[model samples]
Target chain A: MSDSVPAASQSNRGDDFDRRDAAWYVDRLVHLLVFLGGVSAILFILGIFVFITREGLGYLTASFSPSEFFGSIEWRPTSDTKPTYGILALLTGTAAVSGLAMVVAIPFSLGAAIFIGELSEGKTREILKVLVEMLAAIPSVVWGFIGLSIMNPFIIDAFDVPVGLNVLNAGLILGLMAAPIMTTIAEDALKAVPDHYREAAEAMGATRWQVIFRVVLPTAKNGLVAAVLLGVGRAFGETMAVLMASGHSVNMPTSPFDSVRALTATIAAELGETAHGSEHYRVLFTIGIFLFLITFCINLIADLIVRGIRKK
Target chain B: MTMKIAIETHDLSFWYGDFQALFDVNLSIKHGRITSLIGPSGCGKSTLLRSINRINERIGNARSTGQILIHGHDILAPEVELLQVRKEVGMVFQRPNPLPLSIRDNVLFGYRLHHGKRGLKSSERDRIVEKALSKVLLWDSVKDRLDHTATQLSLEEQQKLCIARLLPVQPEVLLMDEPCSALDPSATEAVEELVWDLRDQFTIVLVTHNMAQARRASDECIFMLLGKVIEHSETGEMFVNPSCQETADYIEGRYG
Candidate 1:
């Protein structure tokens, strides 16, 4: 009814224009193209997951019976009439090695992270951070060579261990590789805790250690868990290092000094020799499926735990 | 009222890198009396309070050249133990901050730090923790759940817990910098009452921008402008007969 009415409507009109700006024919075409392009990429990648399962899962089932599969421990699958496909030994080996690696890695990494996050001087902190970050960027193959050439012998001598390429040797080497990544990520998480908590602690006459233990670590629990999960993911997928230094045996681990067979090593060793469509090849694929499931479930559980923490 | 110099600072100056935060703040504070420092933003009221507890020394890139004596101990001297100075002088910040600990642990943490688990068992620690909470008037509501995390308490209760957390060590001085800045009116009143109750045992120095609160709570008010202490006088006299034009200007809202 008045000029003010037009001014009031102008703000709404501006909002409408904003809502419609990206809806013109050209913009719509561009958006549609992007959506289609992303979907196409996903479908193409997903096809690999499907094709592998289709080609691989059938071989394991057709090659061996449930009884044979459950009971067999020998993994030296050679071309013969009576084939063995026992993976209990292999599965146990991988689980033991991975679990041991995590145990060795978590405490040292978390402590170093807290030191870097809380106590280090500015220049020293940056240098230490750079060193850890560089470790994370180093190739897995390089780590393997270093472990074989240097770390394995030290383990053999220091602990008076038997085999140079046993689970303990491999696990220790892998733990070293994972520690830098764990430290860097956990440090970042600890840093995410607000300055207020630190000040509050100090104001209450809390020593620096008390502040770190009671406040910084608890507040950054989500981030610390994320770091550990990420470290586990790296340890799971590692192949060259585990293959090279793990002594590559199908034997179940008795202690840190026993040789072991991780899933990745089994696949790597067998993939080149097996003929396509053979039972061995299918069984190999099934092992791949199982490995993928383990890693997937670990990550999914970690994500759920993180989400639960955030909701609180 | 008996007047005694509880704490004193001489030619006190502080800097954060090249920027001066406090400039030659020479003031004397009385024991067991509330002294309110009122000023506009960037006027260095907060800086003065932090220096009293020697907390400013820990801020990275911050330096001070001053002689602050807490109960006649040279706080700014190189030989003075920072921890001992801190143990005698406590602080409460603008925002309510409770450590991520059990409510009971928060109160007894000081004893655990300074004494290292000697001369007190868990039972005695709990009693002192309870007594500290009662001093701040929070024991009744929170007594049922001493084991609950301090973070779960309401904002005001957390602030009171912060105050209570400082009591067990029996600090001679309490420095509060804008303690009610993050609180509602009701919460602010509760804290004001606690401050008044605390004056019997602790020397209280508070910084506030709220003139009404400054008038209501403080016995002696020190007015400042542009990092200079304008007038340090009794609250009633300073408001009625301000000696400086800058103090009058700030009080009347003419120019900040």
Candidate 2:
């Protein structure tokens, strides 16, 4: 009996060690797969940065005048004899459209978020949430088409503008496009705030509106800032809707009613026609670089602010 | 011969959708005394407490068909403003739920909610904050950092601040739902002492699962079972004298 017991015990130890070895190998394999996944994502972003910079730098090196490119108000890249690559006009057009979009988007989106997060209940809340998400799923081209058909005529008739397609038309569409993301993020932030704060405020005899404004909004302040920054990033980067709605005029726009061409629209419009590896084509990449940097900075600041809020 | 009643509930029945959480609860709580509601989990002690200030209405589909009266006012009346009822009766939750704001701001929040923000000068706010903090016995520890966020304090301090914030509104009654459940034994004792001190000024109703805490801290004890009140008596009498069978079983650890 003693001999049989020792033999069984020895075999159990061997099986245990083999099981542990198998577990170790599986753990290592999972670790390797996760590491590769992370690295590949980073590499893709870095690769885009490198390729854009390499192509864009050729223009700067080949007698591109930084002063004229930045300071002047003309962007006639295909002017045959003297293709002035001044992007000031495009920059202003981009700024005007994005600024107007933000002005139009912030209030409406925040109100929607509050309604969804604080006021809606059960079936209504769920349906509203899903509807907001569906808004985000609509294609940019559809928005552009809608703006061209419906909004253009409305703006022309209502405001008596010379042309239906202008900064105002494009900005309103862009604002619509940006509103979904803003609503989603702001609503998430508002919901993330614990219910206890609301209860405490209510227990102190604060009205529902007062509780939302005083307790919930202040607690979600950083998140709201992040949401706005992210919305700005989305509006600034949007291309197709603005392209179709704006009249694509290469000039510095001074009013919401003026026809204008954004940097994104400029690139989308010109990149197809320009000869490959030419100075003009390279300048387009430079504009791409500028677009990239602006979006990157805004997103980075938003991410940092959100992280700080989460830590607190 | 006439005892003042702080809170009176008549035929109180509460439901969460089809599920009844509380049933026909009739309770008359005396003024200036601490009453502890003790029951097993799911016996609806917390629900009963939350119903007093209509906080239960926050849960979607949760309905109540009953009359709840605070100081002779029918809180469930259609014309009664919910804000006024909440102001008269304050509640502390199971967890420490100080707003993510400065310590001073947390104390002044209730006051500012009832009174407009611009009406109170900075000096007056400071005085109110100081007095409230001092009442909770947190003044000495947090006085140096009134501007600091309330969340940065220890859990005990946070719970105290939660209680302190309610005082500025001068609530006639305080409802605590397991206020010390999140604290250590020593902190629990300190909080119980604070509750005892505040009892003279406010009618305090506390819900606790800890029978020993209910016995040691409360002036009156209520035992509930399966969403029904088993007994309500003086703390000593409830513990020492014979009572309902379920109360005896629960106290003797025979069954929940």
TM-score for each of the candidates: 0.90, 0.95
DockQ of candidate model 2 = 0.77
Return the clash pairs for model 2, or none. Answer: none
Cα lDDT listed for each candidate:
0.84, 0.91
Candidate 2's displacement at residue B3, Å, is 3.0
DockQ of all predictions against the true structure, Cα-based: 0.59, 0.77
Per-residue lDDT over A1-312 for candidate 2, one digit per residue giving the tens place of the 0 to 100 score: 675564455546655544557778899999999999999999999999999999899997886788998898977777878888899999999999999999889997999999999998889999999999999999999999988999899999999887888899988999889998999999989988988888777777888899899889999998999999999999899999999998888877878889988999988988999888999999999999989999999999999989987886
In order, what is each prediction's RMSD in angstroms? 3.9, 2.5
- lDDT tens string, model 1, A151-264? 778878988877688788778778888889889878878887888889877766677887887678888898789889978877887788898888898898888888898888
Residue B208 miss distance in model 1 (angstroms): 0.4
Tell me, by DockQ, which candidate is best: 2
How far residue A186's Cα lies from its native spot in candidate 1, in Å, is 0.9
Point out where model 1 deviates above 4 Å: A1-49, A59-71, A79-81, A152-163, B117-120
lDDT of 2: 0.91
In candidate 2, chain A reaches a TM of 0.94
lDDT tens digits, residue span B210-235, model 1: 98899989899999877779899999
